[model samples]
Each structure stands twice: as structure tokens, then as C-alpha cells.
Target: MSTPTVVLVHGAFADASSFRALIPELLADGIPVVAPAVPNRSLNGDAAYIASVVRQIEGDVVLVGHSYGGAVITVAGVEDNVRALVYLAGYALQEGESLGELQGGFPDSALATALVQTTYPLPDGSTGTDVSVDPTKVHDVFAQDVDPEITKVLAVSQRPLAAAAFGEPASAAAWKTKPSWGVVSSSDNTINPDVERHGYQRAGAKIVEIDSSHLVMLSHPKESADVVREAIRATDR
Candidate 1:
């Protein structure tokens, strides 16, 4: 079989740039990688956008998501040419599950205290709430392992997710049908590590654990890339 293209979807409070470190590693190994910018809006919209990107690819696709991006791919991975799913410290929610619902059962995330919410006017003339992690708390809550300078920049440039996004339940769970792999950030504070393990376990994904923060791809890019490489290799068989 031909090799699959790796489509990366980043989670909340982050943009495609989060995959910068991991991209080159994948490229060095001759793997094609594309990190789509998730809208951080509603799950359905984000999933649809990701699915659209997957459709644009000419060959098979291995869809990978981190954090909330996991939820996006879970709904998007059902695309015909998507051959696999990879979650990096991401949510692999089941049908009818929402990120908020899943996190409710787990220990409270440090992110809860670190978040700041603001109201913004939507194009539809409705008001929407946007959530951003406090820049002062970014290092402790999201990127403890990343360089202090980079974390500062990440804080300022971080994307804010729509407050409604967390409440939106996943309409479909592609993980149930697709082969999946997961990377658990052992020291993740933003999302409980146990919750991550449970999601991966339920999805029956091949799993790897890395000692890093929620931004595992940034802090431990090589290890993160290794898991993505493994997923691509598995699908090639």
C-alpha cells in the first residue's frame, strides 16, 4: 500500500504552529505532514473543516489530533480516505460525548483556574464567549517543559477557543471504526493524564507515554513524531 499523508489538527488555545517542531522530523523521514488550523469553534464545524482538508489530499490520510484536536479528528476521521487516527494528549471521545462531559469526571484541570473568558460579537450578530489561558499561568498549566521564552510567546499568540466549543458534543466518533494510536503526556496538567489514558484505552489505540506537558509535540517533538511515524507505518502494512 502507498504511504498515508499525516494530517495534524491542533487543540484549543493553540494554532497549527504548535506542530512546527514535529513537522520537520516527519519530513526528514520522508513523511508528508499537514497541520490544519482548527477554528476552535464548535466541534461540528471544526470536524467539517478537517474533513474538508482530508478530502483535498490525493492519497490515504492518517489523521492526528492533539488535545481538543482529538475530538475534531474523532468526528472527522470517518472520511473515506482517512486510514488511521493518532491522538497526542488528546480527547478520544465516544459518540454523544462532549469534551466538557469527559473532563467533568476527571480531576479538575489546572486550566480551569487559568482561563479567562471574554465576550465577542459574532458575525451572526450574536455574542460569543472566548476562552484563553492566562498568559501568566501558561507555563504552569500548559507548557511546563517548553522553553520559558517560547512559552511566553505561545501565551501571547495563543488562540482562544469559543466557550461554546467545550459544550458541543461529538456527532460521530471515527475512532470506533478506524485504527488509532495515542500519545499520553504523563505529566500533562491541562488535561488529566488519566482521562487521556482512559480515552485511548477505550479506543483500543496503540499507545505511548511521554514525560512532558500538554504541549508534548512542542516539548518532546521527536518522541511525538515517532508515534506518528509508527501510525503511518502500521497503516502501510
Candidate 2:
């Protein structure tokens, strides 16, 4: 059989660069990978954008999303070249569910307050703000397994999600029909592990628990990639 293509979707507060560490490993194994930059400000536009990318792909694809990107690909990538999905410390939404509703499902945590920022309106009627995480907190909240220098860069490089994106509901739940795989960051503070567990339950996705933080792909790239490869292999059987 030909190699499976992997289209990665990053979560809120991040872009396609979030998959930097994992893509190389997967590519080395002869698996093609694509991670489009998501428009963190416009959820609907972002989903439509990603959907276009999925539609352009040439072969059987495994759609992977991290955090809010999980929700985006669910709505955009469901009926494309995508044959399976991998949620890497990501969200899973059912039909009619929005990211904002999922956020409200659990009580606030340290990460919730950390996400707040001052928003300024733009000439285009959109808004913008800074998304900088404290360097020290990066290790505790994200990839603890990776190099300290990596988190140092990540702390400064974090992207902020637009307030409007969270309110966009899922166009449809991809998990309901697609075979899915989920990687849980047991120590994640950003998206409550409780919330992640809830997503896993809702999707009925095959589960793999990693004792890491929110950025499991960066912290545990090999393991993260392994589970994803396994997910693709499962489809071949």
C-alpha cells in the first residue's frame, strides 16, 4: 500500500508551526504530512480554509488536530481524503457543540485566567492582542519532556486565539463516523483533562494516555507519532 498522508491541524493559541518537532519524524518514515496555518481569529473562515486544503490532497489522509484545531478539522475535514483522525491533546466536538460551550463544561483553572488579554478593535472590525506565556510556566503547562530552550521559544512564540473563535459551533462531528484516535495529556492544564476525557468519550476514539502536558507532540514526539502511525495501520487491517 502507498504511504498514508497526515494533515495536521493545530489548536487555538498556536499555528501550524506547533507540529514542527513531529513532522520530520513522520516524514522520515515516508509518511507525508501537511499542517496548514489556521486563522486563529476567524473560526468559521479557518474551518473553511482547512477544508479547502483537505479537498486538495491526493490520497488517503489522516487528519490530526491539536486543541481547537481538533474542532476545526472535525467540521472541515470530515468528508475529504481523511480516512482517520488523531487528536493530540486535542478537542472533540459533537454536532451543535461549540468551543465556548466546552470551556464552560468545566470550572475555570489556572490556564483559563492565563488566556485572558486586552483586545483592541482593528480597522477591519476584527481585534488583536498579544499571546505571550511566561517562560517558567511553559514547562509546567506544555512540553515538559522537550528541551528547555524549546519551551523558551514557545513561551515567546505563543499565539492568542480570537475571542470570537470559541463561540463557533461545530458544523458537524467528524468523530461520529470516522475512526478516531486520541492522545490525552494527563497533566494538561490548558484544556482540563476532564474535558479531554469527555471528548474521548463522546467520540468513542481509541485512547492513549501520556503523562505529559498540553503540547504532547512536542514533549513526546516519538510516542505521539507512534500512536498516529498505529492509527493509520489500524485502518489498513
Candidate 3:
């Protein structure tokens, strides 16, 4: 096997730019990286979009997902060419499990109080819910380790996720069949750290813990990149 290309998937409240810092680091290590902008409107739709992106890549892929993106890749990473899956403070959900269900057992996330919900028209002409973290709480709950200045900008530009995305049950669990790795953000307030550990442990992933917030890729890009590289090496063998 040869070095696999990396396809990064960002979770709710974020876009492809969320992986900006980690991309260059992966590229520096000679790994090709692609961070596709996830629509985040629906779980199956997002996974299908990512699967299409994976199909366009030239070789095997190491699919990496953050936050809700973990659920996206858990569905998309089952693509034939995907050799590994890496979850960064991400949800590694089981088949038929929804993010909402998995989160039910965890301690209340700070994001609950910080979220702002708005109604929007869906393609079907029905009203849908879109959720985003309150700007004032973005830095504290989502990216505490990052500099407040940058987080301030992130808060304003943050993408909103459709509330339905969380309730959508995952149709696949890629970790069940693929090699897996995980980065547990020890200080994560958005997703309880214990929840992350349980997800990884259940998947039997090689786990690495970092003393960072939910935005580990931003707060600790080097470490995040290193973990991706480790997955590449493990799969390339």
C-alpha cells in the first residue's frame, strides 16, 4: 500500500476552513489533504457528498472527521477506497444510532445553553431548524484553547447546522470494519470528554488524548496532524 490521501470533514458550526491550520501541516508531511465544505443539512446527504469526494481521489483515503463530522464519516468512510478513519473530538456512532441519542447519556454540553436556534425553509418547503453557538460563548465552549481574537472571528463566520442532522440515525459504522484512530480533547465542553472516550473505546481505536478544547485541530494543529500521519502510516503498512 502507498500513502493515502486525507479527506477532512468538519462538523456542525464550522466549515472547511476549520481545518485550515491542519491542512498545511499534513501537506508538509507529504500527505495530500482535502477539506470539503460539508452542507450539514442532513446526515445522509453530508455523507453522500463526502463519499462522492472520496471517489474523486486518486488512491486510498484516510477519512478524518471532527465533531458531528465523525458521524458523517462513519457513514461515508465505508466507501471502498477508504482505508482508515480518524475521529477528532468526534462522534463514533454505531449503526442506527443518532448523535442526539448518543449525546443523551453524556453530561450536559455547555453548547446546549450557548446554542441559538432559527427556523429556515427546507427544500421540501417545510420549516427546518438551524442551530449555531452564540457568538459570546464560542470561545469559551468551542475553542477555549484558541486565542480569543481568532475565536471571535470564528464565532461570527461560524456555519449553522440543521437540527435534523443530529436526529438522523447513522446507516453505517465504518469503524466496525476499518482501522480507526481518535484524538480525545480532554477539556472539551461541547462534547463531554467522557463521551469521546466511550466512542473511541467502543470502536477499539488507537486513542491519543490532548489537553485541548473541542477545536483541537485549531488549538493543536501539529498534534492533530501528527495523529493523521500516524493513521496514514498504520494503514500504509
Q: Which candidate is the best by lDDT?
A: 3
Candidate 2: misplaced stretches above 4 Å?
120-136
Q: Write the per-residue lDDT of candidate 2 for residues 48-68, one digit (tens) a residue.
A: 888888888887888888988
Each candidate: what lDDT?
A: 0.92, 0.80, 0.93
TM-score per model over all chains: 0.98, 0.91, 0.98
Candidate 1: minimum summed lDDT over ten consecutive residues — where? 228-237
Residue lDDT tens for model 1, 119-213: 88999998999999999999999999899999999999988899999999899999888999999999999999999999999999998999999
**Candidate no. 3 TM-score:** 0.98
- Report the poorest 10 consecutive residues by lDDT, candidate 2: 127-136
Candidate 1's TM-score:
0.98
Off by over 4 Å in 3: none
Residues 1-237, candidate 3, lDDT per residue (tens digit)? 488889999999998888988999998878888888999899989999999999999889999999999999999989999999999999999999999889898778888899999999978998999999999999999999898998999999988999988899999999999999999999999999888899899999999999999999998999999999899888885
Which residue pairs overlap in candidate 1's backbone? none
